[model samples]
Target: MRKNTFNIFSFDTTIRNPQRNIDFLQIIDKIDGKVLNEKSLLIYWYEAIGKGIYRPQNINAEIRNKLLKGESLSESEIKRIMQDNPQKVQNGFEGRAITHFKALHSQLLLIYDSQSKVVRISKLGRELLNHPYDVQNIYTKILLGIHFGSPIRKENNRARVFLNTIFVIDLLKREWGKLEKESKGILRHECVFVLGIKDCDYTKCVSEILTYREMYGLKENREYIENYCVSNDLKHLKYDTIKTYVDEVFRKFAMSGLIIARHNYYDFSSFESKKIEAILQHYKDYTFMEFSDIYEYIDFAYNITLPWIENNEVRKQIATQKAKELHISLQDLDFNDLTLLENKLNQTFYQQALKSKIEVSQIDTLLNELRILASGAQEKSSLDNIPEPLRLEYLLALILGKKYGSKNLESNLIYNENGEPLSYAPAGKADLLYENFSFEATMIKNRNQQLNSETTSVARHFYESKKQNTLEQRAMLIAPYIHWDVALFFKFCAKEFDSKLAPISISSFITLIEKSATFSEFSTNFDRLFVDKLLRDKTDAYVDSVNFVR
Candidate 1:
């Protein structure tokens, strides 16, 4: 028994390491006794041997003694025994050091190519040792197989990378699911309903791999064999055919993840997450060949297919409604129209404040000035621009200035080819900056609401030529919004230009409203009285505005 243990350990170690050592069939023959008889003992014995060989040789004397006594080893015992002498044997056993490197090499080849490895042994390999087969425990091993043994990439060959059979199987087992419990699984049905086979099979395979099952035996019927064949929907496929499908599925999944050939392990994991995200970001990323059938399957699994599938009556109704909205035939109303409608809707909301009697001419002027102020304020508010987070403060200043009036506020409007002020790249160019920014629009508005002429307007609008480079960087945009120390403010600019621009006091706001009879009346005067007043200050306050041109 001791000699047999040594031989089994030595043989398996050799077989596992090299590509051409142990004939896998021979190993199977040795272990395949009556399922419940000494063969079972043979299985356990081989298990012990396999465990002993790969395990670190650092066995503690106590645990070693315990294991030698034929006591069933606990996980801790196994671990301790392995750790004490943490090395695997290259050859010798019982002082007979075998130099049969070829035997080891052959064994590894069998392990790699054998059907048993794909079927029974791959599943049972974990049991051959005392190690627990959890996802994390085998993740490194699986990753190793993907990097070293996969057909995708050779050691350093620059070819299209292929995933190993194990990765292929895991991906399918985890990701694919049946369309419905009642719906039979068949290959032809997928090919038929899903539109094509190439991309669909891969998508289905991924879905299968990600799915969980309660019974291990389920693989025999649903996974390993196409036993769900009924009628002409699916004919039972040969092993090679199934293997081909599995291979294609894996290749497609890897391709979708951008796992080209010759990628290193670091490259594989480093970019895998982002690649997966890109694939999942849009439904369109999935190919019609791949997702068409799986779509039904997912719907069925979720119990949403009956209402959606068959003739897709619900879809038709949706299509009809969409067609009505576009005033076109159902066939003419494609997906792009929905996107166009969305853009139009957003634009409507943006124009909500524009629906005033404040003349179309005034609308353009107000919007241009607002854009200038808002853009500048946004740029200055960014931390990158001002070294702090004060976006709200800058925005508040712009908003209040526009609503009340500011003398310290200023702008250089950019005009387009048609001589219209452009919202984006203004026509020519203008660079304007406030020398003094001591304007409080809200305070001025409050004062002006009392209809007091005594409230001196100190608010000014300064203008200059547009800078060679606009504020494009996020840092530049984010800085001005942040809070800065008084010292930092002085360093950025002088204090002489920082005098208070008397914005409309709160009292003045009241007087302006009192002068208006309705919301419409208020809106009419708003652009001229408040917004225009603030905008005109751009010329009034800017000493540079008079001389600067595009």
Candidate 2:
């Protein structure tokens, strides 16, 4: 007789006479209202068995050890055990494990006695022992439960108990599948990547991996698949195919409510509009007009503004409420009446801004300073003969010195043999250094390089400077433009540098300085704007960077 194979659900146990007296419905009823789905039912059943709440006669010591030690037995050990115990092996267990294992099998009978404290298998758990492939549906259902099931439900909690079991089973199935050897290798690499194994094959591409990890939740581990073609040197997996796979996964995640779908124009339902209004209410103390300006300027009209407008019924109610507050009749409410509510809201926001020390006079001063800088930028062509990088460095030095009263602003900075200039006092420390602040500038005209070496070099300078200088001192990277590749490299540097360095496009830096000078507000708003560019929406950044590059 052929030796039986072992699987995730398999167990070794002695058989006993069938227990016809057991009440299956009553046992299920005891779990009713608790097991919400098929996944939950499976979990509850597995847990009860694992805890010895259910014990079959002559349970295999190996299976008992696995449960106690939280380890899985090897296939060889399972086969050896089966070969050593011929008397305990049923006729069905004499063959290799099947590809798919269903829930119900003839050799195993679920036994639960009302008077007993434990539930056990009547003919032992022999039927529980089968090939993992035979149970693909069961494992997939369990995975769905673990990924999508609500934790408040006992069923979900139950499903979690079998998470490891399903993981192992799934791995086994993937290994045993009919996929080509190269495909199998790719899957193995992916598994290692997801586990965050330090020595994984994809570790060579750490920068890309880190960027993908940040953009999408690290739990997805789809980065491995995304980089598969490039990493594995496989030409058949075309870019289009990879893109389709990624898009499909993203769509699935969006459907499951794990993430919002990326869209140009969000079609807001009535409920969604109300939800947005509630969200806006949370930021009611912010500068309403400025906030709206920033939102619209970034072209987030569809993504952010429309989502916050109240539904028709809610708008009508708001109009009526405003009319009542103004001591007017409901019939008197018109489009202008709607403006009353908006004005009232803006008034509250303005009051809050005033409390926060934002004064009209300060804003006017900052606006004037911005105009001066813009004029200077347009008129100054004296440094045009210098290399782009050196010119940018000198320009930033001048701007920072003018703004912050730094004495380090000089046009004729020293240059090294490589044509890279020592723009500031300390060589290679930064291109521009002011009081408690360091700036590094990179202005590359070419985009032919696969990797943005200039961006990486400047980022490295920023990182080293921050380490040598006080961690609290502001370190900024000034770049003419940040294309997609450079943006990804920046993200990588952010992770490696502990997020201490900020990337500032020339345009954004100018805008931020203008805002800060005009509003008399803290320059930390630049950090907020940088974050918005990175994570919220990239429309403004993309447009600005494209024009700058051109």
Candidate 3:
């Protein structure tokens, strides 16, 4: 087995960059059963980023900084960087990309097939593929449940019954808060000596975590320890190595809504102590599933069934509502019930080939979600669990695909080998694909942000996408609100290139959706909105172009 080792000295940096976790899983899902070429993943990683679907953070620092400064690497030089160059195999893009991929594997978010020497997205990884809005809450529960002896991790045995060191911190925070009462929360420095050790004693983690605070008078901003003159800790525990993990865990704890991270201290959240007590009681009743093989374990961990990780009431409400709809009530369904999610809130919207699928029929159903999401009050709906932006992006793909005739429509969102959606639609590309038109959408609210970020990119992509087709083709940019000034900026692009491009507010787009049931009506209605209202009308029309969020 290719052991994914974890100890105090080693911490998964992937937790710090959760946006890219789905991005990573999207790529790994492609090469699930492929053999190792060492360079296979680097190729996929670079290609995805090159196409703009992957996060720019995937770029190696050496190349990213230079690219940001307007310098670029030659084609041959780029190829050379991808070759067999170093003993560590971590230079170039491989360094940043592989580090997170391996750590996520260790977290059981992925599965590495030992016999085949191939990596696959585990069940938990697929859960992330489905929902990412409250990712910190979901990840914390998974992190708390898994221990060294979990069936999936062979090398973590040295951790020896240490039930997720992060879980130990949860206990430490609760216990310390009781003793200190009105005092400040647990200090950062003490965690390195107490909870961060490789063999952290599960039974005594509380006492050890508490002992250091009492012994050293630890509190906020009092973490620096120096032998002579150094910001480093005096006893040489290499605080830098493990401190990021501590900070990240504390941050996740805060988001989990059980614990609160305040400045340099950790404490339980404002919710009554009963919430923490309930979590602990259920945690005690939890038992690790001991499957003989790795695949079975992956399937079990895929849908997080834990109920007490956060607000159990909220989870139960969501679960019950989901059950009521199907008329298939079950006695128990946790926070992330697959039945509630599965295809409902997929990160991607791509489906099987559009051939004879009559996908447009589904747009009626998707409009139900769009109505909730567009109102900016997702909390009251079934779509509440997903981020507003992702839900918007997914709905656009499905609704537009069905509306425009699925075969004629193409969505640029990132997907796996199966052509399913995986993450948010990336920039530098026309987000939605139609024959010859550069149609796109964004949930960005600020006027300046839209102008600075999308002005050139949208105009340029419109021109580029249209170059392969016709000048009669048009471009439309949709957002929650549009700035009059931003509308005028795109007008300049249209005038300069002798092309047709216009920006529309999401409210206007929603209006079109409500009015047009077919592609002909959808297309012609938007055409009138573009030309009749903004193109030939007085410039004052531009002022009202920016409307309230739909």
Report the number of the highest-TM-score candidate: 3
Model 1 weakest 10-residue run by lDDT: 473-482
How far off is model 3, as Cα RMSD?
Answer: 15.2
Per-candidate TM-score against the hidden true structure:
0.17, 0.27, 0.49
Q: Please, what are the lDDT tens digits per residue for candidate 3 over residues 269-382?
A: 433234445555555544444566666655555555555445556445544453453344465434465534423322222333222233424666777777665444323655
lDDT of the candidates, in the order given = 0.28, 0.36, 0.55
User: Candidate 3 — which pairs collide?
Assistant: 123-302, 348-421
Best model number under lDDT: 3
Error of 3 at 206 (Å): 2.3
Backbone steric clashes in candidate 1, count: 111
The RMSD (Cα, Å) of candidate 1 is: 27.9
Question: Who is ahead in TM-score, 1 or 2?
Answer: 2
Worst 10 residues of 3 by lDDT: 226-235
Compute the lDDT for candidate 2.
Answer: 0.36
What order do you get sorting by TM-score, best first? 3, 2, 1
